[model samples]
Target: MNMNMNMNRKQGQILSERFEVAFNQVHDALRDIVQINDDRFVVLVKVGAKKYQIIETYKKDLEQYARLRNAIVHEKMEIGFYIAEPNAKVVSHIEKIANVFSRPNYALSIATKNVVYFDYRDSILKVTAAIKEHGYSKFPIYKNKKCVGLLTSSSIVKWMAQNMENSSVNLSDSHVSDIMTYEKEHPIEIVAKDINIFEVENIFEKAHRKKQKIEGVIITEHGRADESPLGMITAWDLIQIDYTVD
Candidate 1:
C-alpha cells in the first residue's frame, strides 16, 4: 500500500512538471502570434479569448489550468514532492493545447486547390455543367485575368427562381455577368496562404456576428485579390477541423 502511494506521488510530480513545460510552450507560441508585451498569463488569456478558434473554445478551462499551474509552481514542496501535482487529465489537455500551437494547421493546408473558375463572358450552361460534373457549389468569376466576384450555388438558385419559366431557364443565353448581380451580397474574403486555420475560423465567426456571411475565403500568395488564388476555404472547411486536434 505504501509503495503504491509513493508511485502515484511520483507520477503526479512528473505530470506537474510536464504541464509546466507545456504551459510555457503555449505562452511562447501565443507571444509570437499576438506580439504582446505582457506576462505569460495575460498573453494566454488574450490569445485564448480572441486569437485562435481552437484555443478560444477552451478559454475557461485553460484559465483554470493556468491558475493550477501557478499554484503548483508557487506553493512549497512537501518532502520532495510537489504540493499540488497536475493530474493526467490536466497534463493531457495542456499537451494537446501546446501541440496545436506548436505546429498549427494553416488555411492553405486544407483549402481546395487547383480551383476551376469561370470568366465573366462564360456561358451559364458551361458553369452549370462544371457544377454538375465537379459537385462544386462556389466558383470564382474572373474578368481581364482578375477575380471580379464569386458565383455560388445560392446565387444560382436565386437567379433560377427569378428567371425560370415553366421550370426552364435559358442557360446558354445567360452569361456569368447575369448571375454576378445575385452575388453582390455574398462577398468573398481573401487571406494569405500562411494564415492559420484558427484565424480563418475566427473570420467566419466575426462575419456571422456582423450578419455578413462571407461566401468563401480565397487563399492568395499575399492575400491580395490581384494575385492568383492558390486555394479556397469555406465555412465547411473550418467545420471539418474545428474540434479536431492533432
Candidate 2:
C-alpha cells in the first residue's frame, strides 16, 4: 500500500508502468523456459525455479512481484492513482533479473582463458614444464589441430606410477601420447562459445545423476573437437560461481 495522498501521481504512474513491463518480461521468460502457458505467474515461478538456478535465486522476489502485479493491474484506482506502485529500486532490481532470465551469462565468461594445451607428439617433459609454469594440471591434448582427449594431472600420475623405475619416472623420453593412454576416458565436454552457464550447470547435474564425473568443459567456436578451444571450465570454476548472486 504505497498510498501517498500527496505523492506525485505522474511519478508513481511511470514507476508502475516500468514495474508492469518488467513483471511481464519475467513471466514470459519463465513461461517459455518451463514451456508452461496455462499456469499463473506464481506457478511459472514455482516451476521455473526448480529447473533454472536463476529462477530459484529470485523465487521469493518474483512471487512477491506477482502479488503486486495483480494489485496494480486489477485493483481499481482513480485516474493516475497507484494503489500498488513499486519503488524505483524494486523496479530496477526486477529489470535486472528480467534481463538475466532473458539472456543468461555466457559460460565462456567463467572459463579459464588462454588455454594451455598440448600436441600428441609433444614430450612429457614439455607437459611437465608447462604445468610447472602455468600450474594448469588439466590440458586439452590435440592431434592434427583437433582435440583427441583431455589430459589431467590424475592421469599423468597414473602413467608415472606404471612406468616408474626405482621410484623415478622417465619424462624425457615419453611423448604426450604416452600419457593419453592413461587418459582413456573422455571426461571433458566441448561447448559452443555462446553456451549459457545455466545450461552448463544442468549438464554437470545430469552427469552427477548418472554417477559420472565431468573433469572439465572446453569452450570452442563450434562445440566440436575439430574447433580450436576458446577456454576451459572445471568443477572448481562452477563451485566459485554463485549463479544466485553472480
Candidate 3:
C-alpha cells in the first residue's frame, strides 16, 4: 500500500515532508560527528563547526535552516501539514547539505595529486629546481621506498644559512639528507586516502592548537609512510579553499 497518496498531498505538504526529512538528516549526521551532543541540532552543529570545516563553512546556513524548520510546523502538526512550505530552492539546498554530511568527502578528492617529492639522497639543487619550476614549497623525502621526512622551503633556507662559508652556499655539494637535519622531527603526518576530509581538517586544526606546524599531510594507500603517496594536502591548499587551518 502506498502510504502517501500523491493526490491528497498539498504542494506545501510535499515540500514540507522533503524539507523536514533533509533537515532531520542533517541533524542526525552532525550528531554522529559531534563530540558532546546536547540533543539540540544547533548545538551539535556549533560544536562540530569548531572542528570540521564542512560544518564550520556552512555553519550559518545550518543554523538558519533550524529556525526555518520550526517555523514551517503547522498548527495541526501530526497531519504532515505546514503553515508555510519551504521555498523549493531552500529545500533543495538543505537536501544537498544533508547529502554532503552523510556522504562525506575524502581527503584524496581535494588533495594535490601526483605530489612532487624527493629521495633523501637526491640533490638539494634538484629540490630547488623543482621548487623554482613548479613553485611548490613542500616535498616528501623517501628512502628504501619508504618516506623518511618532508622537505620544505623553510628547511632548505635553514640548510643554506648554516652551510654558507662566506656569501655563497653550495647547493651542488649538498643532498636532501644534509637538509633533513635542519627539519624538525615529526614534520608531517601520513594518512590513508580513505580518511574523510573532516578528519583531515581536524588533524590540521589539532596540530594548530598544539602550536606545532605540520609541513604537509600525505595521503597514501594504508596511512603508512611506507605506502606511496596518492595525494598531499598543505596549509596553502586549505587556505585556497577557505578551509580553516593554521
Candidate 4:
C-alpha cells in the first residue's frame, strides 16, 4: 500500500511537470494571438483574417483561462477544475466592453483609433498646412510613431514670429518630438450600456468631487469598450451639445 501511495505521488508530480511545459507552449501561442495595443486600452486578436479588439485589461483573465486550458490539455484535469467563471460583476463588465468595440462607428471616432498625426520631422510649413486643412488648432506630435507632445497653433505662431527675423527657420528640422505628451496610462470611466443617461450624469457629478476628475464615462457592453460611443458625457462636450440643440 505504501509503495502504491508513493507511485501516485510520483504520477502527480510528473503530471504537474508535463502540465507546465504544455502551459508555456499554449501561453506563447495565446500571447501571439492577443496583442495589447496600449495606444488605446484595446486588444487586437486575430481570429482568422479578422482582427477583433478586446479591452487590454482582460489579459489578466485571459491568461488565467489559458493556464487552465494548459492544465486540462496535459494533466487530464477535469474541465470544471480550470473553467472558473469570473464574478458576476466582472462577467457583466466584460460583456459591456465587448459590445462597445463591436460597434461599426467605434473605429471612426478620433478618440478610438490612432488617427493621422503629424511629427516634428515634417516641415513646419507642412504641419501648418495640415492644421489649416483639418481645422484643428492643436496637433499631437510624434517621433517614430510615438507621441512626444502636443503643438498648438498659438505655439507655432509664437515660434514663427519670434524666429521670423531668422531666414533659417526650418521648422521641419526642429522636430516636434520635444513638446509631445508621451503615452501615459489613464483610468477611463466606464458605464454600462443598459444604464440610463441620467445615471451617467449622476456618476459624473459624483466623480467631479473626487481628486481625479473623470474625463468621460465610456459606455461599454460585455465589459469591453466595444460598440458605438453610447455618447460620452464630457463636461465640455455636454455643454455644447445641450446648449446648442435647436
Candidate 5:
C-alpha cells in the first residue's frame, strides 16, 4: 500500500511537469498568433477574452491552471521529492487546451474551395438552375470583377413573393441585379484566410448578441473586398464542423 501511494505521487509529479510544459506551449502559440511580447498572463487575458471563443470559454479555468503552474514551479521541493502535484483534472484540461492551439482548423482549410458565383447582369434563370442542380443556396453576386452582394435562397423567395403578382413575370426576363437588394441588416463579413475556426465561431457569437445576422464570411488573402475570395464560410458550415476537442 505504501509503495502504491508513492507510485501515485510520482505519477502526479510527472503529470504536473507535463502540464507545465503544455501550458507554456499554449501561451507561446497564443503569443505567436497575437504578436504579443509581454507577459503570458496578459496575452491570455487579451487574446482569450477577445479573439478566440474556445479560449474565452475556458479562460477562467486556464487562468486558474496558470496560477497553479506558477505555484508548482515556484514551490520549494525536498531533495528528489515534489512539494505539490497537479490534479488529474487540471492536467487533462491543460492538455486539451494545448491541443486546441496545436491543431487549429483555419478558414482556408475548411472553406468551400470551388465557389460558384453569378454576375449582377446574369439572368435569374441561371441562378435558379444552379441552385436546383448544385444544391447551393448562397451565391456571391459580382460586378466589375468584384463581389458586390450576396444572393441567397431566402432573398430569392422574398423577391418571388413580391413579383408573383405580375402574371408575365419570368426568371429568364429578370436579371440578378434586378432581384438583388443590398441587405444592410445581414452583410457578408470578410475575413483573412489564416483566421482559425475559433475566431470564426466568435464572430457568429458576437453577431448573435448584437441581433445582427452574418450572411457569410468571405475569406480573402487580406480580407479586402477588392481581393478575390479564396473561400467562403457560412453559419451552416460552422454548424457542421465537429469541434469535439480531444
Candidate 6:
C-alpha cells in the first residue's frame, strides 16, 4: 500500500464512522460545485449544466458532511445526490426541501412583498430607479391605483438610445404611462397563490412564447383584479433555479 492509498483509506474510515454507515459502491459523482450564495445560507449544488438549491437551515450538521465531500472532490471530484438514491433515506432528504417548497404562502407570497411597480405619471428616472432597485427587467405601470401596462427595460433602453445623439433630450418629458401597454390592450396571465413554482415556471415560458415581448407574470390569490399584484415573476427569476444544491 502506497501513502496516498493509506491516507484515502483512513479518510474513508473516518467518514464511515462519523456517518454510522457501512461503505457501499459509489452512487454518483458531485460535479460543478456550489455553496452558500444567498444571505439565508442555503446550499447550492451544480451538476453538469443543471443546479439545485437546498435550504441549509434544516441541514443540522450536514455542513460538516458537505465540507468533507467538498474536500475529497477538491474541484476534481463529485458527490452523490441524495435524491438519486433508491433507498428510504432519500425520501427524508427530499422531504426537508419539499417542506420549504410546498409552503405556497412562504415561497410565492414572500416574493410578492418585494414586488416593483411604477406609477403612470412617474418620470423615466422614477421608473428606471424602481427597475434598478428591484432588479427587475420589467415593471407593472399603474395609473389611478389601477394597472395600466407593463414597461420593459428593453423598451426604455431603446428610447434612450434613439435620443442619445440629441443633446436636447429631456428624460423628464417621457412618462412611463405613455409607454405602457394598457392592461386592457394586452392579455395578462395571472398565476394564483396556490400554484406551485413549477406551474408558475410554465406560465412564464408560455407567456414569453406567445407575447415574445412579455417576460413578467402577475401573481394573485385567485387571479382577480381586486387582488393587488402580489409580485411579478420573471424569466430571469426562474432561470436562477437552473442551478442545483445537494
lDDT of each: 0.80, 0.84, 0.82, 0.44, 0.76, 0.50
Ordered by TM-score, highest first, the candidates read: 3, 2, 1, 5, 6, 4
Model 1: per-residue Cα lDDT over 170-230, one tens digit each: 7878999999888765678888888987678768877887988888999999988778889
Off by over 4 Å in 3: 1-9, 74-80, 208-211, 242-246
lDDT of 6 by residue, 1-246 (tens): 699976765555444333322111111111112223332212332221133222223244344444443443444233432211223343334333433333422236434455677777888888777766776666776678766567777777667666665565667687875565322344456666676554565454456556553456677778665467887766566555432324
Model 3 lDDT on a 0 to 1 scale: 0.82
The lDDT of model 5 is: 0.76
* Model 1 score (lDDT): 0.80
RMSD of each: 3.9, 3.6, 4.5, 18.6, 4.9, 11.8
Task: Let me know the TM-score candidate 4 reaches against the reference structure.
Answer: 0.32
TM-score of each: 0.75, 0.81, 0.87, 0.32, 0.67, 0.50
RMSD of 6: 11.8
Cα RMSD for predicted model 5? 4.9
Which one is best on TM-score? 3
**lDDT by residue (tens digit), candidate 2, 71-99:** 88888478668688888888998898889
Q: Give candidate 2 misplaced runs (Cα > 4 Å).
A: 1-7, 36-38, 74-80, 205-213, 242-246
Which residue pairs collide, candidate 2?
none
Residue-level error in angstroms, candidate 1, position 138: 2.1
Residue-by-residue lDDT tens digits, candidate 4, 87-206: 334333433433333332331131322223576677666666777776655454546644434466676666665655556565656544433323232334555556543344445555
Report the lDDT of model 5 for residue 126.
Answer: 93
lDDT for position 2 in model 5: 100
- Give the per-residue lDDT of model 5 (tens digit) for 73-105: 787486435566777777887888788777777
Backbone clash count, each prediction separately:
0, 0, 0, 29, 0, 11
